[model samples]
Target: MSDRPKTPTLDRVHLPSDLKALSDAELHRVADELRAETISAVSETGGHLGAGLGVVELTVAIHSVFDTPRDRLIWDVSHQCYPHKILTGRRDRIRTLRQKDGLSGFTKRSESPYDPFGAAHSSTSISAALGFAMARELGGAPDPALGDAIAVIGDGAMSAGMAYEAMNNAGHLGKRLIVILNDNEMSIAPPVGAMSSYLSRLYAEGPFQELKAAAKGAVSLLPPPFQEGARRAKEMLKGMAVGGTLFEELGFSYIGPLDGHDLDQLLSVLRTVKARATGPILIHAVTKKGKGYGPAEQAADRGHGVSKFDMITGEQKKAPSNAPSYTKVFAQSLTEEAERDDRVVAVTAAMPDGTGLDLFAERFPRRCFDVGIAEQHGVTFAAGLAAGGMKPFAAIYSTFLQRGYDQVVHDVAIQRLPVRFAIDRAGLVGADGATHAGSYDIAYLSNLPGFTVMAAADEAELKHMVATAVAHDAGPIAFRFPRGEGVGVEMPERGEVLEIGKGRVVREGSGVAILSFGARLKEVMEAVEALGARGISPTVADARFAKPLDRELILRLAAEHEALITIEEGAVGGFGSHVAQLLAEEGVFDSGLKYRSMTLPDIFIDQASPGDMYAVAGLNAGDIEAKVLQALGVERLESRRA
Candidate 1:
């Protein structure tokens, strides 16, 4: 309790409406208290710490100035919305961030009216805000009576093509919209590409701080009497300052590279823009990632995503690991493969650290590519690399790879280019929730013609799959692995490339066969042991290749066992579906064989521990055991429900 920051000013303000009653001086204090409160809350229940911390004053100012809930405020990649949530009547539940049935870490429309649009993915806010603005003009939602549509986007998100797409459309429409480009100059990893460089130059030039405030509004937006003066001032400012011209060309009235930490500047600028803006406007506010927190500021990622940490010391309390994380293992394996083969090159979409490609980059600097949140381009780029006689490993998260599906199909699959896709976070990820869950890659990628899809059953299997992906140069190949630690199995000294379209049996048993895909083999083994207690020992086999189908192994399993159950940490139309199709085609089901496919439910599961999430998906050991009992027509006296 003593560790909790003193938030007396924050305690008085329950919502944005309550903030209206406070004076400007009190508002400044409120911003301070809000930052403190956000830090304290996140310290207890760790989440996106630095991004939220960066936007503290900006959040307070926006809510204070705007009539929120009516005025739609959309946060780009909303990981930074924790401070916004705290100010908008959710301070009481702030500590419950990212837990099961608790307040989501990102902005959720279902969670609060204050959250006008839900987003976890980056560069979406501008597009969503434009829609809202268009809707307001067309009288779409008359109930709340939409006032102004505002999108607060980060500079990192600006690197994506989608942000520019929205900007181009918004510029064409010429609607009265507000876009606050929160230029902290950092995304999860230090932002890359031309956008980062452009923003740096925008703020880095000569002293135009004096001319900036005077040229806030577009010349056409000002009164006729003041129009000429404003025009002259803008022209003078443009010559002296390197800022505003790029946005101006895009048909937006650009204002500032103002200090985002300054509440006074934020409030002043927002108030003026809200009162007098005539067309699309963009306010560039410069902020420091992990502002006001020494430890986070000192850290490389700016404390991007953290576990529960000490409030004062900023030391995270991580549980002791029994095994190396799947991410680290993948990195080590990829690095080793890169050593053997100089042709091996890596690519990531602004997720070098997350995908463990940072290690790859450190060893082979020139060979690695960080494409700066442009997944579509990254995929095509990897395809081009493959076409030019290089083994390109596009290491992307399963969920994010969806963005580049068309490129994967057209450029890689159709061209028969050998692009090795190291798909990370291959299952229901914890905390960051449904938006980030890597559920659909198995289904999406497996369905593609000439694409080879494999899921690693364990860390050792992951190593072998990496080796396999590097060796196979016929077509595009992908291997998926989950987010957490390995199953604590003994690892191989070196990965041996396995033959394609084959599977290995883990434990041989009778009556039923449990053909497992991905990391679920660990859970399947546990269920096998529990089934042993029930005198029902089921055969367990790891289906290494999902696309190739492992036809012989699957058919034999179906023929030998009374019932064949296929389990995978993926959605429907994946490994299980492929196996089912193979069985139906082979006439195995007609031979009195009962077949069941256990997969992730159709609905999107929310944030929780990965174990809890899989439990909800009904893919746990108990769920597997119950499923086997049901499949074999063997009733158990003990309730599996409990």
Candidate 2:
């Protein structure tokens, strides 16, 4: 530990109001302090570090210029909001970030008034800000004196259609809104698309700034009668040359490729924009992803997000575990499969590294497609690839896939395309919290007409599931796995494609049957062992497929067992719900069966360790055992050995 106070400058300010009190030079000092605090805080807790570091100065400048609670600062994807959190009354609680009953990793509206619009998914800031902007006008509070709506979005997020949709609306409406395009030249991975190239060019040339000023200067010099005509001509010339050609066509006054790291320059540019009179203006601020921290700066992905590490050495603190991560297992399996089948290709929505497709990309660069933060596009694009007789695996986080739900349903599922969805982080993602938790995918996808949803209980099962997904050609198939390492199970040398909709009995018992789905089966197994020690034998079955429920196996369990408990790593409407519906249809409840559906409770679970979060949700071994005992209507056992 350095002698310097933890979050020194950040600790002093409690709200955006406090930030508004600082001078330009003081704000710069505050930004430096904020960067140090953010880096240190993330180093301790382990979270999205590089993005937050990159936006430290921007965070300070924005809060200083805007009245947050009133102005509504909507962060596109709150991955970069650690500094925002520190400045806005969360400095002390910063260390508790992503822990259960602690601060959320993303901007949450319910968490604070300062975070007007909460976002975990990318490309939503512009839409959210536009909503706030429209609401402000409709509420009869349109006066510039009141406040303005601003959206700080990343260039990577800009690749999504929603960002463009919001930009289109904002431009056409000519609303008094400011959109600060925080171009870090990266999302999780390096950005893709023509827009990315365009932004990069603009940042390098600085033509947008020169042209805007010259156009204004030229218009001002024209005689009174010719002024309007010159203004129109200048607009035309600008449309031809620079003046927000993309945004202007959509209806915005585009400004800058400003240096986001330069505090004075940022403050000056922001102040100028704040003073300007008309329409939606976009200030493009070019920033390096990992600005202050050397270790993060040197990292290939700019320490995008990290585990806890040594502050001085920047070496991650390793928690000794025998198992590999589900991500690693998936990557290994996919790479192995691709090696065998050259037709297999991988795609990610600006999250190649996060989804563990980076290894595959390295091995087969020509086959990997990084579609930027455009999940919808990525899904449809994969559908296109699949249509062309290629095995396109759309690797995306479970939470992010929600953005492409329509595309999945209409483009792939309806069309019966074989788009393999490698859904990573399918359950409660710890530090990132609700924004990143893949709680809804199971329920949502299960409801889809032709969707195949599978959950891996362990590393070996994940390999089998990967093989199964690759082999399936009937329709879309999705396999979900948790965030952390897999259980210490021996990995198979070669994956075996299991029969779809078929489940296997892991443990044989008579009194109770626990239909475990996904990785939560480990907890179910533990509960079973505990129950056995208490002279209460329970059967454990791994329901490999959530959508195509194993009716035969489930029916057999219902007929034989005293009670059936369905456990999944998702929310209410998913596997548990499907199981309940099946039992109800089969008249399994006619005998008045004792049943309990264990799913994530209907609330946004906060950031915590995965184990802690699961414990809170009563999905841990102890919790599972307790729930089973309660369902059995039995008193607490003194000892499992009894």
Candidate 3:
């Protein structure tokens, strides 16, 4: 074997087919190379470093053992697919990972054939893998051969109900499948669940390999019909002792609690499992996040995802910020509210720091709860808190809120529980891209009965919205804000509660009015300034609430202005859609009113700088001004000075 590191070899093989040609020893070398390449790529691009590093060996082993593109391998959440991407004809583009027009931060179906199923959110892989397995059985693939279907999921993702639902179904159906449990005992933060605790105990015990061997030996000793009966009995005994009391009970053949980083062990066990696995099989592989990198491993959050950093020093190169982020503002505001009112409490779904709930947690530890990545549980838990006369703020990211949509409708909205949803990252997230984008909350939340949805136009507005959520005790209320630092706008000394369903006109103008919603107000202001230089002064109003929509103010603006434009930082069905529905009901669009709705285009935008993504979505000031001028039928040259 060459003394040089295997990553250099990995740099040469850009496709899965290339990996297939390599010998077993060469494949082991490729695994090390893949790890180094992944570490280097993430170190440069600043994305899900820890999770991706944890699965490097697993990625190589799976690709080496299975005929990928023919046999689908679905990675749960896909945050750990950097190594997988490197091996699948994407190594050349690794440097451009998360850059504009470059590789996606998560697995994208559009990006490559190797990504059989795309995922950004957690708990999706098992269901998707099962679907692929069923589809293969239904004659979707070129050959009728039962294509291998595997799902590599983390112990953290297993906390969510969907994974269990998929496992239950897969077990019952007795489908030929592989579910590799990549247990690192962390998920952005240390995972929380009875299941997580159970896995941790199993990891400590190290009984899986011994029990499996003993069971197999006993099966081989019996004869004929008695042998089959003994085999079944052995399975039951193994389930009772080790393999899986839970999974085997659900009807799957539980195989391991193996060491994920052990190349020989992983390859040997995988080769064996691949041969005789009749029903669904679960392989529990324990790994260490940030496995190969010392500095990353030492970091507080295990360098889960990072910004561009110094490779030698492991120090992040951060852009200096004048003001705190919207998350911080929300946390501070919520903490203040909790201090003032004993009923106030905060909850997050595995994102205390991201949601700015860390401050609240620090101040009032008992009142704060981090419910792992189970957004559905977080919502219902908040509802339970509310039902018990406690005010619970279900602080979750806008993208994650999608996981609890049913809970929001059934447990909170229908029952009219006062669960304050502090929806963070409420618009197009930049480097993390579309999967993490808070694009659908406005549309999804606004339409729910008894749901009061609001958008913060700025940091001060976010503070007020938090206060409003605290004060409002009637029903489920939510306020969304985008990702990034506040726009250096003046913050309030203390949060002041604002009236529900109200809007404030920021700048007064004639002929054309721009209705700004959420974090897009900064861009709206810039557009207004640009239009002023062009001698066309446009009115700008911040319509705070998406549901109870400041309708009278909107109608007044419509009556006074020659043209009206509705702009929001969400997808088609959100704030703009609500405005359109209101206007149509009021007959604003009946007379062919000069109108336009600005929203994110119906496309999964790739990773890029926030400004660049905004420009692409036409939410930037220049883009907004140009669209407004065009909508009003004004020539570009005529507006050179609107």
Lowest summed lDDT over 10 consecutive residues: which window, candidate 2?
A: 212-221
CA deviation > 4 Å runs, candidate 2: 5-14, 19-21, 140-146, 206-244, 636-642
lDDT of 1 by residue, 1-642 (tens): 777888888888988999999999999888888888888888889899999889989999999999999999999999899999988888889999999989999999899999999999889999999999999999998997888999999999999999999999999999999999999999999999888998888777655655564444234445789878876776776776774567878999888878899888788788889888989999999999899898889989999999999888999999999999999999999999999999999999999999999999999999999999899999999999999999999999998999899999999999999999999999999999999999999999898999999999999999999999999998999999999899888999999898988999998999999999989998999999999988998999999999898888998899899999999999999999998888888888789999999999999999999989999999999999989998987764455543
- lDDT by residue (tens digit), candidate 2, 1-642: 563345555566888788777777778778888888887787788888999999998999888976776778888888899999988888879887877787888899888878878888888888888887788778844454337889999988899898998888888788898888999888888888999888776645444456544543223334579778866765665555544457667877666667788887777667667766367988878898989888999998888879888778789987887788889889989999999899899999988878899999999999999988888999999999999999999999999999899999999999999999999999988778777789999999999888899999999999999999889999999999988788899989989999999999998888888999999888888778888898898988999999899999999998998888999999999998898899998888998788889999998777778888887787899888988888887754445536
Cα distance off (Å), candidate 1, residue 214: 6.8
TM-score of 3: 0.92
Query: Which candidate wins on TM-score?
Result: 1
lDDT per model vs. reference: 0.91, 0.85, 0.85
Worst 10 residues of 3 by lDDT: 213-222
Higher-lDDT candidate of 1 and 2: 1
Please, what are the lDDT tens digits per residue for candidate 3 over residues 498-533? 888999999899989999888889888888888888
Model 3: how large is the Cα RMSD against the reference? 3.5
How many clashes show up per model? 0, 7, 7
Report each candidate's C-alpha RMSD, comma-separated, in the order given.
2.2, 3.5, 3.5
Q: Which stretches of candidate 1 lie over 4 Å from their true place?
A: 213-227, 240-244, 636-642
State the local distance difference test value for candidate 1. 0.91
Q: On a 0 to 1 TM-score scale, where does candidate 1 land against the true structure?
A: 0.97
